[model samples]
Target: MTRETLDRQLHHIQDEILLLGSLVEQAMLNAVQSLKNRDRAAAHKIYQADQDINEKRFAIENAILILMATQQPMARDLRMLAAMLEVNTELERMGDYAKGIAKVTQRLGDVEIKIPIQEIEQMASIATSMLHRALGCFISENAMVASQIPAEDDQVDRLYEEIYRQIVHTMIENPDLIDHTNLLLWVAHNLERMADRVTNICERTVFINTGELLEMDTTDDEEELDSE
Candidate 1:
């Protein structure tokens, strides 16, 4: 009920959010490493990291629940708590998406095959940086930076589309590589989704800062950019 208690709760939630961010970064790194070196153990560790994300999500939700029940947070406080809920959910899904990529890596490890890992690594690096920026925007309370996340995600989307085309081409040309190529294609899809979820967190951050949700549309991004 006291201001001190509320501040403490907010601080605790912030810490949880940061920890979630760290888990996300680790997941991306380990997943890419799995693909690069065919490291099954690294993939397994990435999979295991998902548990930490889930636990952090639970902890954040619990904190929010307690704050609402006891602190009676309203107005901006209510907005913050709601955004925190959305942020944690997005982060959880992103973590799962990362695990999905890692799972594909683990599967490829059993077979004696290799695919172009660099494209995926490049995608991962850019997407991870976008996620890192979203995390930074939240911590700095920068609505402008948060709102710009969708534009940053466009890069990842383009890379995903490119990779998808290459994978489909490779599969069509060499039907024997269909299974492996499809696996890599699915991994790119998962990473794209992860980038999307990271963008969602930024939208939530913008909402927290300005009290409005701005949904970004990628459908006409090309035309929109050309006109601009």
Candidate 2:
């Protein structure tokens, strides 16, 4: 295949990845909002939208195979194609996390929130914005902007920490709020994990674009439990 044709295909693949990012962002936002509004229908809608995310993921995988098989790109081009595959995997996981949040929302339908929704909402906001900015970084091949996303991820972690501390304090002091508060904690944990996955995608983009392997804090990394 001609280099021009291969490049065009890469661009198209990148666009599909960005489109998947948009879907994940929308799903996260809608899930959180549905929970806040106690609208199970809206929550289920977010779950239904995940079908599109899955379809787009299949399309991306096909693009990856075609690019790898036909183009036979070397070095940088190959890293980019591989990175796209990795990032899309993370995006699909984010989509699943969104659906998980939506399922929780659906279960809690019409149930008044016992714990505050502000932190998780904030976490979702930061995560969705990071997902968008990370996609922009991918399009522009801007490792700098991609590096900045880890800071936004810090916001998600801080919100998670704050939520955890608050819930612990409330549980110890109030006792009665346990069942309801535990569910909210789980929701916040999922949002926090999703945000961490966004950072992982950003790190992969930085590596793909710049060939620099930079380490960032990952709250979702389960090795910490073993270490502790």
Q: What's the distance in Å from true for residue 61, model 1?
A: 0.9
**What is the C-alpha local distance difference test score of each model?**
0.82, 0.83
Model 2 per-residue lDDT tens digits across residues 1-228: 558988999999998998899999999899888888878889889867999999999889998998899879887888888889988898998999888888887776565546668887888888888888888987777887788787777778779889888888877876876776677787888888887777777787788876876777645558757754
What TM-score does prediction 2 earn?
0.89
Model 2 alpha-carbon miss at residue 178, Å: 3.1
- Off by more than 4 A, model 1: 110-114, 220-228
Backbone clashes under 3 angstroms, per model = 0, 0
What is the per-residue lDDT of model 1 for residues 112-209, given as tens digits with 9 covering 90 to 100?
65566778888899888888888888867788877878787778877887887788788888888788878998888888887888778887778887
* Residue 206 local lDDT, model 1: 80
What value does the lDDT take at residue 226 in candidate 1?
Answer: 97
